[model samples]
Target chain A: MYCVETDHLTYRFARNEPVVRNVHLQVPQGSIYGFLGQNGAGKTTTLRLILGLLKKQQGIITIFGKSFEEHRLQILREIGSLIESPSLYGHLTAVENLTIYQKIHQAPKNRIQEVLELVGLSGTGKKKAGQFSLGMKQRLGLAIALINKPSLLILDEPTNGLDPNGIIEMRELLKQLQREQGITILISSHLLAEIEKLVTHVGIINQGQLIFQGTLPELMSRREQSAGIVLNTSDSQRTMGVLEQLHLGGAVESSGVVLPFVQKEIVANIARELVRSDIAIYGIQQRTDDLETIFMNAIK
Target chain B: MHLLNIFQSEWLKRRRSLASWLVVIGGLFTPVIIFTMRMVYHQRLSLPQKFQLPDFWQVSWNQSWESMALFMLPMGIIMATGLMTQLEYKNNAWKQLHTTPQRMATIFCMKLLIILIMLVQVFVVFNAGLYLFGILPSLLLSSVSYPAADLPVAMIMQWNINFFLDCLPIVGLQYALGLHFKNFLVPFGAGFLLWIVSMSGLTWEYNYILPYSYTMLDYLVLAGRKIRIGTDIHVMSVMYFAVFIVGGYAVYIWKNEKG
Candidate 1:
């Protein structure tokens, strides 16, 4: 069963302008669903709607096989979220801040120490939250979300404004949570590269619409449809002529000769024809589009 | 149990806040200032045998209550409410709080309750300060004796209770303003302006409609008699409290949940 499902979800800040329009999301249980969208693409707004932070004007949201409106409290109890910036009491110490949430969640007192250690903030004794660095603040936010041991975690732009090392740490932490705890995570990011290695499934959104949703491999398969071949020959003009005789048309460019990549057997046939014609083969390579290129094309 | 947990959590959030300190200091301001001024006035009149101290306990109570009702209490309510709500806006914590499993009404009510608790603490501390200052000065002055026989404990308690009830409408209105505006200056300025207008030389009938004037109207000393209770003023105060508290919570829940 899907952990989170939204059907024709719609939202608007003003009367006439709809920020999210008929957007459907399918997040499988126990999968890291990466929500990809450009800035101002309604990714955060959609997350807010699913979390029940904003009232839904249209469509239905179901979580854990229950409608959002019917079981809001129960669903929310099982969910953890970090939206935009970390919500913290800057005047309070790191431990004090976590203690506040722990009391609210009615978790064990020891859970505060556990989450602080999990987020690598145990050593930050007596340091006020406001004095924490950006990366530290993000980690604390994640720690707060994990304090309840929630079944589902929703993080919007969690790695935004973090240094490279901080990003890697956050990525590893998320992976560990999914692998060890079997927790389902729904994370949103505009940079595909940031979440590419961590997410098992992806949903690309554009202009308040879900453009694509599927497994990582299914998204990668799109690149195969647009794949092509490149050959670096000793003699380009002669290679094009030899290809025409074989009923294969190609184009010669600065890199080499370009042709539509069809199958593995076609490469062998092209090689045999070039060797037979005494055109010394310098090199040949097949190129498939990367995920970033595929994402760009899909959004466009 | 759930509401208690929420209240405990809300208290923890402000355990170390500067607002708590400000409330203590603001509460002491009126009583301490009036006590010191009265001490100096008595010292200046030491030579005049004809200038006897006017009922010492009544004078002290009147001075403390007037300063508090006219200026300090209104400003304290405004500051307390502003400080309580500013924490949410400063850290953008409303979004975080809203997404929790707790009902929005529970959260809103818990916060308002905490603010009320803080105001009560201030009121108690201010009375304690007034009593201490009033007693110490009377012991030192030869001409002015503590009116222990004239001022009964029940009378003081009754006066404190009445003043607290009269301030409820101000609490509700300030809290509503604090929740509605993200900028502290706007609510603070509104409270200051309204307070000044309430204290101006407007018609006595205007006090019936103004929440800030309730405290001043509830108790008055005229012609050597203490008018400690006004039934009409108490009724109006209760009505204003119900309106603002219910209306403020409704608006808060609606805006936070939907807007």
Candidate 2:
């Protein structure tokens, strides 16, 4: 069963402009679903909607087979969240912060010690959270969310502002939670490289629209059959004219200087034509699979 | 169970706060200082006159309470308002705690309990200090004029009864203003300004209307009046406290509705 599902979820800050527009999302139980988006792309907004932090204008959000509005408290008890940046009491210790959370939840006192150890914050309990390193603070925030042994964890930009080592640690912890605890995690992150390692599924969003939703293999299969080639030509206009003359029109990018097409022999003809047009040739290459490049390509 | 947890956590946190401690100590300091001054000036009073030396400086439970309320009672309320409201906005401690499975009612009541505890400590310490300096010394050493009424049950109960009734509305008002305005200065400044105005008698005409006026209970005691019921003071205090309780709940609901 889908742990979380959103059907035609539409939310708008303005009358005509929707920040999250009819977005459909499915998160499988015990799966780590990576929500990929650029800044201001409504990733955090979507997570808030699922958590019922923000009111849904139009849509149905079901978590653990229960509607959010009808069963908010029950769902909230079962699902943990770290919304936006880390919101914590800076003056309190990591232990004190968790203690406060523990009191509110009426969790066993032993749970605090266990979660502190789980987050690798066992020895640093008494140290004030404000004195913690940025990475430690991030982990403490996550630990607070995890204290109740929640079935689903929703983290918004969980690794944001962390160094490479911090990112890796967080990534491994998320994987461990999913693998051992059988907890489902929905992580929203702009750092595609980090997410690619931990996520079982991905949903790429841009400008409030989910452009792609599939597994890694499915996405690769969806790629165009023809390998992409970047051709540097002197007369970009003449090269385009030659491609049309040769009837090899796929798409021309980069001010018409770089032409991408399916046919390889077309490059030789196009290169020869550009040289004959008295335009200097610089370089040419094939496009490899990279998230940055793919993301640009997808949004563009 | 959740309410108990909220109370324990809120109580422990308040105990750890240096600001809360400062207010508590500051609340009792005036009584302590006055007791010291009274010891120095004991010789100045005529034996007959000293007998009625206005339990003002006497460090007994009843008299110390009267003196403490004169200035430090309001100070304690100011500190409570500052600490409680600032927790919600400045550090988001309130928000962080609210995120847990605890109900808002529990958290809100825990905060009210913290304020109540602080108020109790202020009075308790004031009484303790009086017993040490004003009452104990007089009973052990010698009586100057007035017989030291240490641990005077009837007077203590009467005084505290008036104090609790008088303090209820102020606590409630401070809680409401503090929660409503996240800024420490606005509510505190308003309290300070009202205290000054009521002392000056300009706003004393509308004293019953202002929530902070009940802290002026000592003024009635200074005028040599016995505690009575169904007076204008009692009626006004009940009205102000009712408003405070209703307004505080409104603020709590309003705050919870938003971010």
TM-score of chain A of each: 0.80, 0.87
Quote the lDDT for B238 in model 1. Answer: 81
In candidate 1 the C-alpha lDDT for residue B196 amounts to: 79
List, residue by residue over A1-300, the lDDT tens digit for candidate 2.
999999999888657689898889999998899998888888988887787655678999999999977877788788777876676677788888888777766778899988888878899946887788877888888988988889999998888778898888888888998999999999998867778889998898887888888885665654443347666665566666766776766356763444454566766776787677676777767765565566666766
The 10 consecutive residues of candidate 1 chain B with the worst lDDT sum are: B221-230
Clash tally for model 2: 0
State candidate 2's DockQ: 0.40
Q: What is the C-alpha lDDT of each candidate?
A: 0.82, 0.71
- TM-score each candidate: 0.85, 0.84
Model 1: clashing residue pairs?
none
Where model 1 places Cα greater than 4 Å from the true spot, the runs are A223-292, B38-42, B45-54, B137-151, B219-231, B256-259
